[model samples]
Target: MWVRVTILGRCLTDGQLALYRIPRTKITYSNIKYDWGGWIMVGLESECGNGKRKSGGCQARCAADGATARVTAWTHTGIVVCASLALVIGAPARAGTDDAAGNAKAARAPVKPVTGRKKPAQAAAPATPPAQPGAAAPATVSRAWSAGPGTAPAPSAGGAVSPEVAKMIKFAAFDKLSMKGWITTVPPAAESIFQDPNGLRTALAEYGIGYVAYSTNTFTANMLNNAPPKPQTYQGQIPTTYSFSEVTVSYDLGRLGLTGGQLSVGTMLTGTTWEPLGPSGAKFANLYYFQSLMEDTVQLQAGVFYNAQNYLGLLVAASMATGPQALVPYELGLSRQGVPAPGANFMINLPNNFYNKAGVQRSISPDGADVEQQANPIGLGLSSPDAKALFIDEFGYKTFSSPAQGSVWVRAGGLYNTSPYFDFSAGRKTDTNWGFYAAADVQVSQISSAPYEAYQGYYVGGFYMTSDPNKNMYQNYYEGRVYGMGIIPGRPMDQTALIFGYTTLSKSALDFQAALTGIRPFGDYASVTVSNSFRLNPGVYLMLGTSYNVHPSATPRLKNSLNFMASLTTAF
Candidate 1:
């Protein structure tokens, strides 16, 4: 089988074959052959001595032919894979006169004998392929093939030709592919509180050690000093001065050879005195890290946490740099009052950027030793000291988001304070308590040219809880609240919070209240809270707020009272 080959430098990009072999002579043909397994260029005289082909090699020198050179053929060998995860082939060296006419003379390496047992013959390479895209073209690239029969050189020895089909390729190139935001908290410029107070927090976070602390000192003044009007009336009982502070340290144990989680510990430090208004301390806000899963789709959280939104994300007790406490969720911090307990939280990421979380923990003492007893049965939500209590909470979120339009989230949460707190018998309390809530959180920003108000947040929620009358507290109660936060235009770092809340006690509780107050005080109670927080800077902030309360319609179950509170807060 004889064939002609185009030597394009160190590479052979094209090939053709001649059907009939021509004896040692100066002639060329284009009929491609396919049986001998290799394309033979200039054929040598077959010196068959005793029915076996002899090694009758040929030699040559440069001839004054301006067009082509000598041709030396090599039997197809092995192919090595190439390119950047791509493919390329190194052509075997040819050594003989190689020219288009097949007889041009030139000096090359000596020919060697083909030995060993004959193996199955595979077809030699056929057509030349185009240069790789993005590759710099050499001064001499073989004829460019478009696609069809006369265009692309036929397939290679590997069989089917890697046809050089024209393609309209598009791509992109960037200097780098990296970005960053929200390291530990907002950077100083965008934040008014705890802006990396000491260069320590920022430095530590950079080093994978994130530590944060916050302190809030609040002083309240009542225009109408009044105790709960009726013995059972749930009204303003705020103390004059109270302070709450916490410090949390999170260590990225991944740096210490531990993996998949960070170790965090938070301590409440001191407990508060008042029942309703806060500073209510329950030490060790958080004790474990155990964030085993971190993916958006599913996550497993174990360790100690604030337990519920009340003492966790709710800013009513402590403000977050993100925004104001626009909604005052129920004080669901009974068992783990501003404290952290051993528990596990699981989160599932749903479609459309929605998510759900559920968690449970030993009410207080894992061994049922000391379950935190409530100070005001109503305020503490039925945490009994005799029986073991298991706090269970589940919450879900559905969100609508847009950079320009801002974001909105619809949230539903339910908690089962599974503890028998009812006074069924003189000595035994067997009633269980539970509550549920649904709220919407909205935040609009001016990231883009949307007509959304900059720095605004609004939230409204409805809450209901099963109360016990024999406990001298609320019996079957329900409440709702609406609150909002917005930056007064031109008020640098200043924000305002306006909230309204209404709670109605069940008839049983109302009846008890009527007996205590002598008059059947209506079962309804209402209050309005207004607060303005001025961020002097990232390290300091001042908040002045007031609450106006209106008790039931009956005799002064609780007279209208106006309370004002001032707080100076700082964070690190």
Candidate 2:
């Protein structure tokens, strides 16, 4: 067990004066008595009370008499010590083994008492102006096992687990484990009380396993619609909700003697309350896959997964009002999350922050938009027989891993689908179908320090994509965006973004829309979206946004539509 001592007159932020881990054999009744010192040390110890001079056990002198001593301990049984039991455990004289010279050296160590406490006059006025109403103080973890008395652990890009999983209750050696936020009697700030009821969630983290689960539910309503009555409504004025939940489990292959290897699998559940939501069914976001890294220079992944999971990822454009329009060129028929096809990815990490990645995945049928999703909701079966293979490649320069120096990512990629399709406008069959896209994002301004918030800043980026107009309904796509996080004075976890996008529709797509609605379709479409997200708690977030669509394709009679949307995402 380890004992932490606090000197009553001092005000250490963590309230720790010294910490000592002592073995069981060195303990003595007299040693315990003097070490505790009646809850305070009055003066230098002249004797060990055992009538012998001992180097170990609490041996300290106070500059003044009658100061207090406080001791706390974390024991083998996961119990924090009671004050009486703490005294019996005894605080060691100093760090290291019993030695007169070491104790003397520790005795002479200086204590730099905090000098920042306010004076009477200074205390009368606020040192810093107060925040406006509803403004929050930076969040602090109050659980005992948090990093410090009131400090939270560094934010991680991962999820949480229950305490029981940290150390199987029956194992004595593992029972004494010390982990941030894992041994606490109360739930950590990131988790709800009801999570991990069975203790199986975090059971393998100690063995190099990892787990993450989250749910994202979004509600959208089209407030205005202007179009000639149509066979299919344009998400017209009806509110709908999209719900997606997923859990992923990963293992470090080092545990099995394979260094630099990682294996992971993800299962997802999704549904929609009204209009079709993207990928609306239960499925495997990504099936079993193994990734290997070689000398930090080359990486490879094989098994069932999506091309989009490996390439063309962007943080600034991660959240949009409608879909992945600005971040992913879905029109190119590359495999995606929840409907990933079998594939392999190879990447070479180049010098000076450059990299190249290439992949090939089974392309899903493009005849009907939801044919593959309906036939393979589980994502384990083969893609449609009519579907062919899809090849994709990308090259990029990024500084995401070293953000303190600067933050920027520039990339370009192309995709080719080996499938036949008819020209959208000419009604001619074609076997050649391909597309190309380029994108870049750069952080223009800094917000908080890198540690407090690395990705919080003003970011600007643009994307342009072009495909074979002969066979694709959308000839070209363009988008520009500005994203900012932690911009508010006290809300380091808050974010705001604005995005603008445009798409040109082919004549055949317009003709089909005209046929369905009995009116000519709009020639093109443009939109602007604005959103703000707030971190309501450690692992929960709320986002509200709105989008204005000009020249909406479905309803050509009305020139525009206004839509509102909100989403809640929770992590566990």
Summed backbone clashes in each candidate are: 20, 0
Compared with the true structure, what per-residue lDDT tens digits does model 1 show for residues 350-423? 77666666666545421121234232222222233433444554455543322223344455666554545444
Using TM-score as the measure, which candidate wins? 2
Evaluate model 1: give its TM-score: 0.53
lDDT (Cα atoms) of all candidates against the true structure: 0.36, 0.48
- State the lDDT at 545 in candidate 2: 71
Compose the digit string of candidate 2's lDDT tens values, residues 111-138.
2221221111000000011110000000
Model 2 scores a TM of 0.64
Q: Give lDDT: candidate 1, residue 255.
A: 62
Q: Which candidate has the top score in lDDT?
A: 2
Residue 551 error, candidate 1, Å: 1.7
